[model samples]
Target: MPARSYLYVPGHRPDRVPKAAASAADAVIIDLEDAVPVAAKATARAAAAAALRAGSGGTPLWVRVNPGADDLAADLAAVVGPGLAGVWLPKAEPAALARLDDLLTGLERERGLPGGAVPVVALVETAAGVLHAEEVCRAPRVVRLGIGEADLAGELRVRPDPDRTELHGVRLQVVLACAATGLPAPVGPVETNVTDTDRLAHTTATLLRQGFRARTALHPRQVPVINAGFTATAEEVAAAEALLARVPADESTAVDPDGHFLDPAVLRTARETLDRG
Candidate 1:
């Protein structure tokens, strides 16, 4: 299944890393930017490197690095290694990502790693970055895109509303850019209201409908809800299966019992749903 939920853990909290890895989350992001204080960045990098070395097996493990910070070089040096899956470039700009691509390339070669060994995930958190999202998504090493809600709101001079009306346009733009590049749609910086699980699930469902394949969770309790929202529903799966079963073998098109037209594309989607289960 596509990774649909990413649990964010502060890199400085090494103890949390192991627990996060063992969670049901599809991916875990060891955050070194907003989650880590400046003085503790070095320590966070070291801890994150150790956690990566410990092994995530198959679960995607990514490290979020400060993009426009002076410590980025050192952050890259500490986090980019054989066991690390990818790097999340925060506050990423198109030109900056191009530079990051080069840096990652050189680092991989120097470390005797294969080309494109470490994919970069750009975090579009600024008006400038969102405006140039297409270029950023097309960067050589970029494999995914993300949104930083707080930073984006600040850049756009808007309040961080739970509904995120102001960000809807940029969010759609990011999704479009990702789709155009054949990359996973950007996920959301979901509301961190763990006590309000219903609201959390509702927010996640909204993003899922908008074509996002994943979402970030600050609290462990949010993981399962986010996963549930992103996963294919039983009703949807059943509908897909019913449609596929009605089609004759070797036939690419058919008419459903309801007189609706069915095409190969519909069958393909149905097959995919069952396969996912």
Candidate 2:
């Protein structure tokens, strides 16, 4: 999916799901993990499941299921059905994904959906998860990966770094994992500065430069900012289109006024730019 913005709606607040789905976000994730209190998880799961069944206003619907070993089964049972695009396995590790892949396969069949219909988006939020991200990327049914930096900071016992300087290696490792596994470039971590549009846009642009093609948003206002950050600019799209236009059908190279020799590699980049638009 070409999701530029993935908006998160708390499972406990089902009322927000429809609103979020209707927003400019390319996808909406119903969160049953960090957003909901432990005592309210069951109710939140039920609410989120109901919203999924109701439909997503043409937006893809994902569930960020609680991944604790004891509660994972319950979370899966409640949300694994029609309307679920995938699951966001939080604090995800390879062992959990392997188990989830098998269990999700069975659930898909039992629920009358095609096997592997519901893919996974692994959320890497720990130092261990960052180190072994490639393993998680290769896990069965995982389509893409996500950076949960807030939780990762908590795991590391470090304060959240607004500049994300502390996460430089972590982000690089996650990108390398996707590259190694042939998975799509993963979405970046959420930006907590929802109200500060300037900061939000800057952060999203910064992450995009760092190889994050998409980002999760805590609020709907952030969706458009993320989308704009990930989207190709009009000038960029025109340049890409022009570059591709100059390529002869027989050869995949184009030269500019500077006479720099362009190659098939540049052609691929141009196509990707157009695709992003």
Candidate 3:
């Protein structure tokens, strides 16, 4: 909900759930999909349900359910209840989202919860998911979109360079889809090497420039870097403040003392920068 940092705690590790919730992350996601082993999915589901009831400190708690029908049904049945902030649908596509919406509706009605109360964050990971990104973002109850880089890379057989240039287009596709649908900018993918703070920060900066307002954190240490990356720097804040002071709010166009052209779009960005700061 804060759109700064989303920390992931493996559902099978219930002990880590509270710890993650207490971290600096704006939200915590209990991963019941890739993070859980096939044999332990049931265990993970049960743990996720318990975590939901216990609460997520002050942050929102989301459960990332599996995409498969049987597994997803079990996942929703176990975790869709009080204290659950939303559902993160992995490998999300239009049809899968439709099914999820129906399932959630029935679950909420059966449990006496408010209809459409649960929001969904769709993670587009597969080739089909990426191709149908706009439709996925427009799906019912979908509040946000995210990319699953690892799965996506595997599907496309792309070995990106250190800068991840190969996936740039894919990332932009998700960003454009979110913009077109008027949803908040999509969440950036998690950087798997938790120990590499430098790479984490660099990639986070890249994501920020590419229209991502938040990123997923695989470890608590990654939270600070992500939070900082999304925030406006002092230099950025100063530039924004200067530009705003030079141009009136109602003015659509202006020229600064340095003769730099300022348009409505630039003014809007300045205001947004101040807000972020």
- lDDT per residue for candidate 2 within 156-216, as digits (tens), equals 8877567978778788899989988899889998888789999999988888888889999
Residue-wise C-alpha lDDT for candidate 1, range 61-128, written one tens digit per residue: 89888886467788888988877879888888978887788788888899999998888888888888
Sum up the clashes in candidate 3.
0
Worst 10 residues of 3 by lDDT: 244-253
- Could you tell me how far off, in angstroms, the CA of residue 147 lies in candidate 3 after the best superposition? 0.5
Error of 2 at 110 (Å): 2.5
CA lDDT of every candidate: 0.84, 0.88, 0.92
What's each prediction's TM-score?
0.92, 0.95, 0.97
The TM-score, computed over Cα atoms with residue i paired to residue i, of candidate 2 is: 0.95
What is candidate 1's local distance difference test score? 0.84
Q: How accurate is candidate 3 locally (lDDT)?
A: 0.92
Error of 1 at 15 (Å): 0.7
Candidate 1 local lDDT, residue 58:
71
Task: Order candidates by lDDT, high to low.
Answer: 3, 2, 1
User: For residue 273, what is the lDDT in candidate 3?
Assistant: 91
Model 1 ranges off by over 4 Å: 249-251, 263-276
